[model samples]
Target chain A: MALDADATLGEAGEFGLISQLVAQLGEALTDDEHVLVGPGDDAAVLRVKHGHVVVSTDLMVEGRHFRRDWASAEDVGHRAAAQNLSDINAMGGTARHLTIGLAAPADLPVQWALDFARGFAQECASVGATVVGGDTTRADEIVIAVTVLGECTVSPVLRSGARPGDVLALTGRQGWAAGGLAVLGRGFRSPRVLVEAYRRPEPPYAAGKEAAEAGATSLIDVSDGLLAEAAHLAEASGVAIDVRRDAFDVPEPLVAVGAALGADPMQFILGGGDDHALLATFPDTASVPAGWQVVGEVRDGEGVTVDGSEYDGPTGWTHF
Target chain B: MALDADATLGEAGEFGLISQLVAQLGEALTDDEHVLVGPGDDAAVLRVKHGHVVVSTDLMVEGRHFRRDWASAEDVGHRAAAQNLSDINAMGGTARHLTIGLAAPADLPVQWALDFARGFAQECASVGATVVGGDTTRADEIVIAVTVLGECTVSPVLRSGARPGDVLALTGRQGWAAGGLAVLGRGFRSPRVLVEAYRRPEPPYAAGKEAAEAGATSLIDVSDGLLAEAAHLAEASGVAIDVRRDAFDVPEPLVAVGAALGADPMQFILGGGDDHALLATFPDTASVPAGWQVVGEVRDGEGVTVDGSEYDGPTGWTHF
Candidate 1:
């Protein structure tokens, strides 16, 4: 039934649909130490830590965030969870719980929802978070709204903490998703690795804790283009960041794919989006943790630049 | 600029739109003791209490949960906040923070967004909860998904905790919202009070705590019809709930409206949704707290009965 496209959400009914979701999620969760009460209740009761809980939410709409034709339902669920988890990671917190609200048409395949639930549960398990609670309702289009709560024992990193003389660093892939999107847009699907990267992003989940422990001044998740997000960090910290493009060697696949698609590899590295990389600022690159690459430096100014000047390329993504 | 109808979300751009919303919310918030980090960060960092935190999420979609014509943008925002808050309150927890995910058409007026922010901030303030974080995106229709985090020092109440001989009690108005919908559906604008109930429900926020303190065994928020929710409590608790309709003396205004429209007031009281009433079960009616009225009893059996018989009227509401 979970794989049947003919099984619609309406035919499944509300309670029945919820039962399937709860069953799938309940199986993935093992630790109840933090959970006092879980799903099938008015609200979930979570045993919170005393100091701080990092909370963030993201909305992924059907057409605006992802195209159904380009990605599977499972991929949609995975991307949604990955993007939000990266947000918690950027805050130097470990995600422990999540609640997702799903809005989809009544005629939507129940199989899609089941696959979505599977991906949601699987992602949470991968990060050691649990799907504590959620809500579902009928709508014209599908919308997945995920809110994640994290436990941070140490002082959480702030975007405003970066200062002059700080080194800017990055971890994980950059521009891979957008590069994949470009390939798909050009009717090229042979680059399976690039397309798979777009389908299932690999965020540097553990790098955040490592950076925080090693004394990160500030951090951000690279969901938007690298240049755009760097601008955000610059503005928040009241400092200028200078990026050296030479610091990054474009991955061979992306470079080859860019050449075939007539796209610029540098632009993919700088201005492409949805590769959930961790960007951080450290006072000294020598002490920087593993998996983190120092790419730039923060100075006493505003805005972001590449090689001491602003690069005239695509800066960010705006859904509208 | 916020009041200008011509100023649309797309015209404002994503960063600009976020700045406007953040400024408005920051201005509304006066305290930051509980907020480790607010908006503009990757995620909000809240000072979590040592005890359990109650969490809930709900999704409201245009044309399904609300009609833009029937509800003002502000009203939609308020109701959305209210419904989710009520769920937390129903669990006997105090709401502390909320994150909303909004999906709307690119052409939606910025003024409408401003109005929604105002209402959301105001409502959160009313309950001592702050708007911690949110997401915004473009879609064909407007969808507001809210997630609330709450703290409960005492053990959280569950719908499955009711025992035989427990008394059923209710707080806040019932069927008023449905009655208002009935009036509006008929295109009648004369009844101001009933219509206002539909636009913005005044949930009994304080009653939940009082009931919990007084020892409510089971509790639920009446988002669905009274009969429908009663059935839920019965099944979950594995007990029979016998509701006496005669015990609920229909308010004169509702009775008059029902009479005028040739509709049964009792039916409205039994089968209406979205009144946000707190329904709970206590060991005895004598212990029912203030602002609560005992209307029925939990007995040894299964299913819900109206005056010891299955209700033949509208049993529940299925939005689908």
Candidate 2:
């Protein structure tokens, strides 16, 4: 049968479709305190106490960002929400609210979208954030854009504040996500370590707060790789960093993936991206947290170097 | 010559590339005041006063949203920034800052990206907003996602709370953008008015603020056609709306496009989308400002009716 006229975006219409989708989402924000304004306005407003607000955004697209075959709708939603929240955490801020913009094909099952929403809510709950508002539209592919608002009690950590002779430390595992991706891409069905890494990336949320409280000079999330992010810190602070190869205590999953791929585990630790690990530079006398390992030191050089030399493999992910 | 590997995103790497791009933008936020923490941390923080914060986001995909042939990099940037800021204006807020996320192919011209940034900055300047923060990555296609943050001294206007017997009023012309799209699609170059509407939609920003000040019960932006938005008000308020066709003053551009496309001028007015006009419900005694025209009334019905009857033409934009 020919598609019904309403099936086309030109027919059922933008406003009507948006209203229908929005109606499906039950109100998460009460009309009381905390939320000054909610959905249905041009933008939702929340009450801020500390006078400063932390903000971050992420966009996940079909095919490029995630494959439907590899990840369920719920997994996509959870990952999308987690990534953005992790950014807030990295800044030593607590995520308070989020706004999502979703674009997907009409033929996709509505259940899929609902499932994604559920995952998003679950992830938000982990960090005490609520979905405040969102926009939904029809597109040829699925696209999820999430913006998160956060609150910080103390000052936020910046990349440009790392001084010469500072110590560099990292909290949380590295190369797990990249290793997991390699395993999945190669059609490895073992679901223990690699799958866990891919399904849920546990960022050191509490560690970031501690680092900030401990007086970190600079901080960044290891989303793009250890060395890659260190380079950023170096460039932003106008300092050079040297990573000690022996400093890495590679995780078991990364070692397993390296063995399977016939690759070096060190390469994954240094160059793999998307672990959501927190990398911070602190004064030389600052004590490292329990989970954090001192990996390098900042100097007045040029860029990130491994053992005072350039050790290059894959540097990290490139968008282009 | 073949493209150099280093020039590609895969070679430049995500972390290094982001660092390079961010360095070019330099520092926009102050070190202490507005920016408690700048980029390179997990997130960025900005300070705000004791006023409501307005936020809106939009996504523009290459091919689907805009063709490269029809719009330059600068035009796409301008349009993306305009649409998001307009949403804030519709809520009776002033645009303050914008965060952009861009995904483009690696081989794409760097100049194009720079031009896009310039365009975005220019548009933000027009609306009194700054390009605050954003993320950029490599993808197979170009995608521009923008989120704008606005501020308001008063409460924001919402799409709900319209009372029965309220007058429905609109600011700016309707259906001109739809007419412009028609002219462009048909390759008809004669009508400059229609073409301009499609290229840049002029939202009645000041008028929205005025409507809110004049005691509008509910307000919405006409991103999706007049009738469609009116339907939203009716559904949200549990009331029926009646449109007076005789009251509509069809703009000259829409009339010309209708003549050229052999379509009814009313079709463009009733169902055409993307005019970015402000639609609000006001009390009978409320004074309608200049550029705003009354075209309908809210009543104790269930749906919207044109001339006291159901409109059988296209309902609005569909997203399936």
- The TM-score measured for candidate 2 stands at 0.91
- Residue B197 in candidate 1 has what lDDT? 91
Q: Which stretches in model 2 have alpha-carbon errors above 4 Å?
A: A1-33, B1-42
Best by TM-score: 1
Task: Assess each prediction's global lDDT (C-alpha) against the native.
Answer: 0.87, 0.76
lDDT of 1 at B195: 85
Q: What value does the lDDT take at residue B89 in candidate 2?
A: 79
Best by DockQ: 1
Give candidate 1 misplaced runs (Cα > 4 Å): A1-5, B1-5
Candidate 1 lDDT tens digits, B1-320: 35344689888877778878887777645585788789999999888765678999999998888888887889887898899899988998888899988899989998888788888888888898899899999999999999999888677889999999999999999989888888888888546788899888889998787788899999999998898988889989999999988889798778877988998988778998788998999999888987788889999999999889888888667755
- Against the true structure, candidate 1 reaches a TM-score of 0.97
What fraction of the true interface does each of the listed models get right, in terms of native contacts kept? 0.88, 0.57
